[model samples]
Every structure is written in structure tokens, then in C-alpha cells.
Target: MGIFEYAPAPESRAVVDIKPSYDLFIGGEFVPATGGVFKSVNPATEEVLAEIGLASDADVDRAVAAARTAYERVWSRMPGAERGKYLFRIARIIQERARELAVLESIDNGKPIRETRDVDVPLVAAHFFHYAGWADKLEYAGYGPNPRPLGVAAQVIPWNFPLLMLAWKIAPALACGNTVVLKPAETTPLTALLFAEICRQAELPAGVVNIVTGAGETGARLVAHPGVDKVAFTGSTAVGRSIARAVAGTDKKLTLELGGKAANIVFDDAPIDQAVEGIVDSIFFNQGQVCCAGSRLLVQESIQDELLDALRRRMGTLRLGDPLDKNTDVGAINSAEQLARITELTAAGEAEGAERWSPACELPAQGFWFAPTIFTNVSATHRIAREEIFGPVLSVLTFRTPDEAIAKANNTPYGLSAGVWTEKGSRILSMAKRLRAGVVWANTFNKFDPASPFGGYKESGYGREGGLQGLEAYLDV
Candidate 1:
């Protein structure tokens, strides 16, 4: 029998009906934007998906005013049990429309359908579900005998994991009795707008949860808005710094979940097969756009060659093409601008004497796509190893000792996440204590749950986003 190619099994685009032009979801309804509209394209095909309205400073001000009004007149005055019920409704609605949302997320954000279905959408629902339970139990949540909500929260989420990041920002804020004005990333606003419909479906009060779509200026206006009591952001570290400076003199409570160049350390004694899979999932999942992605690989010197061989073999099998395909592993880059950043960083890695290798994977000609790439002979000083590439690119740097691995892993300005692969339980515990990152994955990589608190130390940004710790960010102690 002759070998055959796999037939295309694309998911139907009809699953999500993209509107001709979307307006800002402010107060209680979809309102027109003062700023002009922009097109959101399917990164996999460069096809225009929908026209998204951009929010100017005036729109942001209006949204914040709505949030404040809702917080004072409705959401804040509502009983805890009632608030919990509303969140529960939102969670149930999200689960009900998960398929539609996942397909839309894949189209608008360029993540594989597999991820949007299994990871993003599920986590979005899980965050609401988890925070709902906390809503009625806030008295015992360890904050204080009486905790109060911040009046209005200004939340800005990144394009990567658009809906999931919104859940991270909004669920806890709402659960804690604060109304929110959320800004989804410019490249991906469809899901957040869809979430606005979800709020209406839940019969959530007008202005309880408003979504204003735009670029950085919109976010800047939101965070700096005097009426906003809290500000939360998830994106680049440089932008996080800018937000920090923007709200410096203000009373806005800030929590930033920013960029990372997390180190994935592999010891010689680690289970090689599992370690290889962890390495792939760490950097390749979501096309490595994850804020806590393990972009830096520190393999023990004795196992470097063996680990690299396994990693290369694994990378070869990752299917990169249509994000809507059920079998696709890697998806298109989120945008042209982000692709250029990845390209520049990777080229610098090559120019600085690092050896780069990529599996022979074909990419679509029309879209922004970068293949699963790895660089050997990488040093701690190399730009690819040190900087946040935020793409499916890994820098392999070998370490001979556990102390050296720890040293190299904490060398960066980012301390969001790290993974340690080892068979020794004692060593894992010891190293976990030593690692400066906020979240550490032992034996596995990129695992997240609603019960666990997630955030980072140092420049990776501050404040927890899950579990009981997350509640404090939106609460007044």
C-alpha cells in the first residue's frame, strides 16, 4: 500500500458568528466607540474575522463610570450568596457555550482548537466556578473579619489566552463584590465581547462587568482613571512597568501578571521521556506565547545530548497548520508585530554564536508562523536565553551542577515560573525552596488549576491571581 497524506479535518467556522462590526460593551449594552474601529483577522489565514471598535479615553472614562455606578448601586450592595449565584450562572453559561467560545478563540487568537477547548475555555469556567465558592465564604477567607470590595476594578488582558486571562482578572474581582471595566487585547476582543453577552445571559446587572476594547491607550486611560479602585494587567513586563508608573501617584491597587523566560531544568536522573514531553509542552504549548512559558532549557551536561535528541524527535511530531483542526498542535503566531519580535530575537541568537535547529515542519504561506525551534550552545548571556522571546523558541544551556542550574534559572529579571525535572523527591523539595520563581512545576510543566495561586516575583510582576490569595487583590482589608 502507498503512503497517504492526512485529509483536512477543519472545524466549522459557522460555530461562531462573527459580527460585521462589534461595539464596546459598556454600562449594560453594546455602545459605539468614539475611537475608530479596527479589523481582527484570523491569524491562521489572515482573513478578516470582524471589525472591533476601539475605545478612546472618553470611552474608557464612560466604562469606568458605569462600573462605579454598578458597584455602588447593585453589585456591591448585593448579598454574598446572591453574588455567588450570579457568578455560578456565568460559569454555567460559559460551560454551555464553551464550544462556540473555543472555536471563536481559535479563530480570533490563533491558538489551536485543542488548547481553546481543553485548556482556555475550561480554565475560564473553572476560574468562575472556583471564585463563586469563595464569594459566600469571604468572611473566613483569611483577609479579615470584614473584608470589602474595591469600588471598581480596571482589568487589561493580553491577546494570548484572551478569554482565560479575562476570567483570571474578572471572576475574582466580581466574586469579591467589585464591578469591573475590562480591556481585552486589541488583536483579540471577540471572546471578551462574547463574555459580555454571557453576563447578560446570566442577567448580571448593568455595568457590573463592562468590556472596553482597544490598544494600549485604552488600557492606560483605564488604569489611570481616578474612579477605578483596582488595576490588574497581564502582558509584557515593559508594559507592566509602564502601568506601574502610570498609576504611581494614584490609589489604584495594582496586580500585574507579566512576561517570563522561565527555566526548565532537567537533571540527569530525571525520567527522560517525561522530561522531553515537559520540555515540548513548556515552550511549544500556545506557540510559546504563555507568560510563564519555560523558554529557557537548562539540561544537565551529562544528559544534554540524549535530552536534545528526544526533544528534537518530539518537536518533529508537532503538527503546525490550521488552528481549527482537531489534530493541530502548533498554531499561527498571534500577529505580524509579535512575529517580527520573535524573528528579531531568534536572529540575534544566531548572530551571537548560538546554534539553532528546527524540525522540518511546513508552515502556511499566508499567515504568521514560526516552527518549533531550539538553540543549542546557548549561554546565559545570550539574548535568546535571557530575553522573553514569547514564541515557540527554546534556548538550551547545559549546567553541570544543581547549584549551577539554580543560579542560571534565577539569572533573569523574570521570576514567574520554572520547572524542575528530577527523580529525587528531596532534591525537588530543596530546589523548589531555592528557586526564586513564583510557581514551580515539579516533574511536569504548565499545569494550572483554579485552586492554586499563580503569579510571579520581581519584574515578572506581583500579586496572586488564583485561590484565596487572589481574593485579596480585589478586596479592601
Candidate 2:
């Protein structure tokens, strides 16, 4: 399908109706939890899509126990090539149901359908296909000979890219022969529940992959559960640290892909229009909910004014409303809580004396929304410049030279990704080498491929996903 075909619609009362009372997937079957049930809301309209069973501490234990049993009896002992076939089957199924997943994802997560269809669904499939090939070729991976599977993996993903993040977590774990008990973010559990159906369609072994839906407390239960052999998390830095501390005394391996305040540096020698487009995609795509968003723009002093003008023009042209529309560029903020957080952080930026500018745009009533905001004259120490606002907010800071740009870019605790906009190949290589991030895009931003290893340095969290290195996270070296 074409990219433009997935544009989002404006706000309307129309809602995606999800089945009520989704059960936890345990032992390859949909089963009710012993705990209470909770409803997941569509952030765009505040409509409940599904009532999901909230897994209690005991439920998490049961899920982990089931995973451990599956790991020992079936999944771990399965032939590697057979496991690859199962993954391939699941990928194909995902592609078949791509549109449904896209619509459901947009309804549940409040991201534009274009992103859900073009980016999230496709990448989810590609991730599965990519890792499926690795299942039968473990010896070729950089990990040492006779790599063994980690037992039961407890994975918790964020709300931003629910199903895609679930794919990233489960594909590699299954490929490495580890059974998974995944917990999707409470605000967006529909897609993950739908994914459990896909697993069933693939006839995956019972207990091979379980989906537990709940809030932070349930996630803590799953992660801190004694039966979990490893924990893979993608969320905020604070929660990542907590999970790190939770697993400190245990032998459980941990892989965290946390928050980022990436720098998108535009050099004087860069292609201005292209760099502007890259900057827009970096910060504005996914309504700036992306963890590795290029929230900080460090432009060369020579081209700061021109780049800022172009960026503003681009931001002004963005259509904001209706995640399901076929024309929307920006969608609603995920939830009111997140919008409040963005507002608070932006207020801090203004209070800290950074110049804030947002295009004069009308936001729909009755839905959580934030205009695309840009802060100029932002210093390294500015609260907005230093902290991760995590909405469609960008902080523009200037640097006079290459060294200064690199220094300013790496000043933050985040090192997830960086964007260097330059025409000169030598400059791109040099600046990329100096940037302390995992993924560096020379002329682009937020480009993801299943074959590329992706993660971060410093507080952005550890462990790579999507490449051969991703397999290492699930395998015992």
C-alpha cells in the first residue's frame, strides 16, 4: 500500500469497537485471570475499546510458570528451522491483517494510521522475518558456539508503538527459543491482544508466547516475578532504572531500550530542504511519542535562522487531527496525562527562559492534543533542552563549529540516536564517529530496518534490537 493511503481523518464520534473482556493468553489459550478487569481507552476520543483482565501477582506467577514449562518441554526443544517457519508464518499473518492492526492501533494508541500502517506494521513484519532467518543460523551470529536460550522472558513495552514493540520483543525471544510473557502498556492493549490471536493462528505451541494486559503495577509484578529468567523493557528511564534495581540480586538478564533526547545536527554544508524534512520526520512523526526522537536540534550558527524558518514552515503545514484520516500529518497526543506532561515540560522551558513557538493551529475539542512546539534560543542547561518532553516539541540550539556541535549534541545523558545533516561524505563520517549515539543518520532521521542493530548508550539504556545483536539479548552466550 502507498504511504499516502494511510493518512488520518479528523476527530469524529466514530470509534473502533473492541471485544469486551479480553483474557490473558496462557498455555497458548485465552484464559480469564483470577484478578480484576480493567478497560483500555482510545486516547484520541477517550473511548474504551476493550476490557482487559488485569493480571495480579498470582496471575503473573502463573504465566511465568507456564512459560517455564513451555521453554523446557516444547519451545526449547523444537528444531531451529521449525521455529523459523513458525515466525515466518506469524509474519505473513501480520501482513495479512495489517490494515486491521493499523486501524486498531490508531484507535488504541492515538498515532496516525499512516505510521501504524507504513511504519509500525511493516517494521513489525520485517522484524519477524528478519529474526526468523536467525533461528536456524545461531552459529553464524556473533554470539559464541552453542548459544543456549534464556528460560522465561518477561517483556514490558511502552504505549507509543504497542504492537511493533511487542513484535520486537517476542520475535527474537521466540527465535532464541525462549518463551515470553509480554505485558503491553495499559493504555494500548488491543493490538497486543489481537496479536495473541495471530499467534494462535500460527498454531504456536502453548505457553510459547503469553500476553498479559495491565498497568504499571502488573508490569512490576511480571518483571519482579522470581520465575522470570530475563526481563526486556522499553519505557522511560526512571522505570528502566527501577527494573534494573528489581533484577539486581537475581541472575535474570536485562535489556532496556529506554528514553532519548537525541540531537539532530544540521551543518552549514547540508542540503537545507532535505534536512528540514528530516528534522520534521525526526521530531514530529508519531506525534513526537518516539523514544529516540530528535527533540534537540543543534544547527550550525551559519544556517540556524534559515533552518529554523524552513522547519517552522514545515510544521505549519502539518495537519493535526483524526488518527484514522487519510490526510493527517500529526495525530492526537496519546492521552491527557501525556499531554499534561508535555505542557508542564514546555511551561518549564518557558519559565527557564527558552523562546517557545507553536504554529497557530486549532486542536479538536474532547481529545488530548498538543500543537507542534519549537523552542529557540535554547541552551544546553535549559530544562526543555535537557529533559525529554516526549511530545511534538523540539528545542533548537546553535553551535559554531563541528567540535562544538558534537560536544553540545553529546552533552545529554541520552545517546540513543543522532541525525547529522551534511552533504560532505567526509564530514558525515567524521561527525557520525564523534556522536555517542547508536544510530546515526547522515541525511535522514528515524529510519528503522530489521537488519540494523538499534539501541543506545549512556542512560538511554542497553542492548540492541532488530539485528544479529538483538538475538544476543535472548540467547545465553
Candidate 3:
């Protein structure tokens, strides 16, 4: 069947006001970078949205100094109830400006409007709301009778789910009474900049939350800064390793949420219809730009053919186009560089003798886009099966028994997340127990809640980032 075309139902760009240029938000104000500035462009149209300052070593030092000052003078001295009030205000403000922020996120980050609006924005607010409640109640959280804040926290987040990741890093740090110097990904700094505005609206104290925008060099400086008491990072495993090395032998507290190559195992007893939907949402959500995206699909040998047929039909129905479009199921890749990486890996899959298939979808002329792709007849030894493809690509492998499925699923260096689809409750429990992943979803996939702790095992990095456990990363007993 041929692909169907739809008229552009683009969300209004008027919802967001893009400034000509943005400065680093430090000590409660936007200031020029010591290093020069760079432009953040819309990956969907290759249009320059705004120019953002690149933080140099001096800039990082200034931001960290500001955070340290705030930690010592303001945030740490404030009462927990007062801190909760500020977080509550920030949460309310985020909810109020959700639409504007969502539109801006769609433009700046190239995620579909539906995602920024429906999934990302909502979660950002929820994290604040959830963590806000924990502020005054930390005495009961089991860390200690009076857990102390970790002072100045240095956080570096990734481009995918920019605002959501910022929320993940910032909310817990703030709720635990720690001041923060956050560095958003270079390509997606607008929403974090917008978040700075929200902080102003919430009347957060000066230097309590600073955002220094730049790339890896900037992040390196922030991590290495002596004033930073704790460091949290979410990015590539290689970078995570570097941050660990940089902070080694220091008293700096560190948490790293890195890469994943999660397995989605389907047994013959699974309801094919629901499993197909779960599979689609698992990898295709966020254009497969998720850290724990289910890139490996493991099917029982008896049901592999039927499940594959169903999966192909469903993949065909996905709509890929303008990110601002309200109906877009898959949006543009975040950047040209990311597109090149996805291309290189998929080419390797094809060259390595796996059967590659993609839905009949037309990519946009301008911007980075990859059709939803699947590689069948995949082996555990294949790069596509073992490596983290961080794109809309899936590697399909078949197993003959429950033992084989478990073996294949747990054969990776990464143990971030995994999924199992089966009607047998006993099997689900057994498999869930056996899977080495931090999160296991049975008959479902890709679910997240602020009340639940989320992180990974092994090379996927360390330290939990949500729920009560999240606060532990920012506290001292």
C-alpha cells in the first residue's frame, strides 16, 4: 500500500516568541557568555530560532560560584516549607504556560507538538508538583531524620525531551534545598531558557537556579568546577564515563543516566493486537529518541511470523512530517549530526545481512528524518541487536523457549529497561524477576511516573532519578 498524504495542520508559531538572541541565566539574570554565542535552529525547517551564548570555563566558574553562594546564603538557609511554596509556584506557572512552552519546545527541539504538549510538558509539571510535596516531608522519606542538602549541584542534560530532562534534574535538586547550575543541551536550550523565565515568575531566589548554555566543553568545565558539590548527567555512556573520571577523587556526589538497548520480548500467548500497539509506542514514541527505547524486539518462534505481519501493518499507519503539526506521529530528528549517526548505524545493519524494512512514508525535503525501520532475522551478535541505535530503528530476533527469550534479552551490557508481553501471569512474574533491567513492563511499555524511581543498571549508568530515591541523590545524611 502507498502512503497517504495529509494537509498541514501546523500549530500556530505565534504561541511562542523567539528572541533574536539569548544569554546565560546566572545569579537570577541573563548575562553574556565569556565564550561566543551559537545559533539554535529548528531541525524541522533548518531555521535559526535563536542565538544562544556558549559557556566558557570562566562562565561555568561564575555560574557555579553563583550556585555556591545561593546554597550557602539563601536556598540552604530557607525553611523546607518555604522551599515547597516556591516549587509549588513553579509548578503552577509551568501549567499556566504549558501551551506556549509546548509550542516553543516543538519548534526548538523538533519533537511533534502532540508530544511536547501531551507528554513532555505534562511530565515536567508533574515532576515539580511531586517533588514540591516532598520538600517539607523529607524528614519522613527514610533518608534520615533531617537529611541535609548537597549544596551546589551541577547538572548537564541531553537534547531529547529537553524540558522534561531539565525538570528531572532540577526539581529534585531544588526540593532537597540544593542550588543548581544546569547546562541544557546546546541544540535545545530555548525551553530551558523559557524555564528561567518561569523561575522569575515563581519568585525563586537569585542564584538558586542558574542555566549556562553550551556543548561538551561547557559541561566539562561545570563538572570539574570546584564549587559544585554534586554532579548529575544524562547523555551518552562515553560522556558519562568521562564525567565519572573527571569527578573521581573529589568529594563531589555524582549520578549518571546514560544509554540503553532495551529488549521487548513477546511470547506466543501474548495478545497480538495489544502487543503490536505497545511495540509501536515503545520505539516510535519520540521518534525513537528515548534512552530506554525498546530497540530490540524478541518474539517467540511460534508467533514470530504473525507478530511481524501485524507490526508491519501498524508501522505503515504512522504519520511523519512537520513537528508543529498536531497530528504528526513521528517528527524530525533533533539535528543533522543525529541524522548522520542514525544513517550510519542503519547502513551497518543492512550490510551485516539483516533484512531491513521500513514503512512507505515520505520524508520532508529539508530537515532530518528517518522512516520507522525494522531489521528482521537479527542475531544477538549483530550491532543492531547489541548496540543502542537511539533512532526509529528496531532489531528483531526470535527465540524458541522462555529460557532462550530471557537469555537473549539479558545478553547486553546495558540493563536500562525491558518489556514482556504474555497472558501467563506466572511467566510474566518469572521473566520480570529474571530481567536485569531497572524497569520491566509486562503487557505494557514506556510508562513513567514521578513517584517511581527511574535509572539503569550496568553501563546504562547509576543512581535513581525519580520518587523518594531521587531525593537521595541530592541529600546528605
Superpose all Cα atoms of candidate 1 onto the true structure and report the RMSD in Å to 1 decimal.
1.2
**What is candidate 3's lDDT per residue for 120-155, written digit by digit as tens?**
999999999999999999999999898999899999
Q: lDDT of candidate 1 vs native?
A: 0.93
Reference-based lDDT, each prediction: 0.93, 0.90, 0.93
Query: What's the TM-score of every candidate structure?
Result: 0.98, 0.96, 0.98
Off by more than 4 A, model 3:
1-7
Q: Write down the worst ten-residue block by lDDT for model 3.
A: 1-10
**Candidate scoring better on TM-score of 1 and 2:** 1
Pitting candidate 2 against candidate 3, the one with the higher TM-score is 3
Q: Tell me the tens digit of each residue's lDDT in model 2 across 90-204.
A: 9999999888888889998889888887999999999999989999999889788789998999999999999989989999999999999999998888889999999999999
Model 1 lDDT-worst window of ten:
1-10
Model 3 scores a C-alpha lDDT of 0.93
Query: Tens-digit lDDT track for model 1 on 1-477?
Result: 543456778889888888899999988899999999889998989999888998988899899889989988999999889999999999999999999999999999999999999999999999999999999899999999999998899899999989999999999999999999999999999999999999989999999999999888888888888888999999999999999998898788999998899999999999999999999999999999999999999999998999899888888778899999998999999999999999999999999999999999887889899999999999888899888999999999989999999999999999999999999999999999999999999999999999899999999999999999999999998
